[model samples]
Target: MKLLRWTPLALALLAGAGTASAQDKPDPNLARNLAATCAGCHGTGGRTVPGSAVEPLAGADSAVLMQKLRDFRSGARPATIMHQISKGYTEAQLELIAAYFAARK
Candidate 1:
């Protein structure tokens, strides 16, 4: 009788824990989605064709990429389009993007 009474409570608690765990984990697709914007010009996965005018982002140094992104965001870097695009991302999102591209190679 006690086990039956406790079963529903235990199930509810377990369900609640699953919900909390899901909420606590960042969305796996978030970084990819955020980085997708860059693909229009940066090339897919930041891999540009050889001899392209734009620099390939794949395997870029993370520190340099982050700094460049920060500069664009802060208006320290002059850009034809990146300045505007960079403004769209939060600092944390930019960090995720930097990490994403830096790992692409």
Candidate 2:
């Protein structure tokens, strides 16, 4: 009788545990991590050194960034390497990257 009563409670707890663990946790630093890949050319915090030919991304408008990235991804923009590079990121990742840079000063 004791086992029978506890079995239901145990099963319920196990099921709840599985459900909780199964839910995916979004990374808090995903945008930063993704944007880190651009630091080489764009510079840290999206701010390039003065007089650098590569345009600074810091403080750029998100709409413009999105349009530019989308263009590069779609091959509509003529870039020696951006087109190829942008191809590697998913649409959502691209959005995150653009937003991340847009937020930086």
Candidate 3:
């Protein structure tokens, strides 16, 4: 009789445990998610709209992208807005964004 009464409590605890574990797992699309912020200017997958004048990041060299981002963050490269935007991300996040765009065709 006691075991039967406790069964519901045990099941509830188990269900909550599953939810906690799921939340603990890191998102698999982190890089893509991080890069999505750039879509406003860089275009989807880093391909700028035709004749848009904004430089396309798609298929660019990762090293070059890294340098450009670093410059933007450091104010070494003058920009109307990029310098301000670049300052928001850490180096690791910038690297991920660069890698994601470089991989896109």
Candidate 4:
């Protein structure tokens, strides 16, 4: 009888914990490491070199960055390399990469 009475309370607490964890900020190290692959072309922290044709990604909107990455992964946006490269990462990883670049100066 006691176990049954506590079950709902336990479930609610577990659910709340899950929600709180989900709301926590992502690990910066994870995002940085995942985004490292982009450094070769996008420059360190996604800041393109001066006079480069490549668009600077630093401080770009995360939504825009994520959309571009998704397009590359999906082949909806044609690219010389991004299409193939983007295919290597899962959508969640790509979002992390996007957030990493967006947060950069």
In model 1, the worst 10-residue window by lDDT is 47-56
In order, candidate lDDTs are 0.91, 0.92, 0.92, 0.90
Cα lDDT, model 3, residue 20 = 98
TM-scores, all models, native as reference = 0.75, 0.77, 0.75, 0.72
Model 1 agreement with the true structure over 1-105: per-residue lDDT tens digits: 999999999999999999999999999999889988888788999988778888888899888999998898888998898899888889899999999988898
Give stretches of model 1 more than 4 Å off: 1-23
Clashes of each: 0, 0, 0, 0
lDDT (10s digit) by residue, model 2, range 9-56: 999999999888866777889999999999999999899999999999
Candidates 1 and 4 compared: the better one by TM-score is 1
Candidate 2 achieves a global lDDT of: 0.92
1 versus 3: better lDDT goes to: 3
Candidates sorted on lDDT, descending = 3, 2, 1, 4
Once fitted onto the true fold, the runs of candidate 3 whose alpha carbons sit more than 4 angstroms away are 1-25
Cα-based lDDT at residue 14, candidate 2:
99
How many residue pairs clash in model 1?
0
* TM-score (C-alpha) between model 2 and the true structure: 0.77
- Lowest lDDT block of 10, candidate 2: 19-28
User: Which runs in model 4 stand beyond 4 Å of their true positions?
Assistant: 1-28
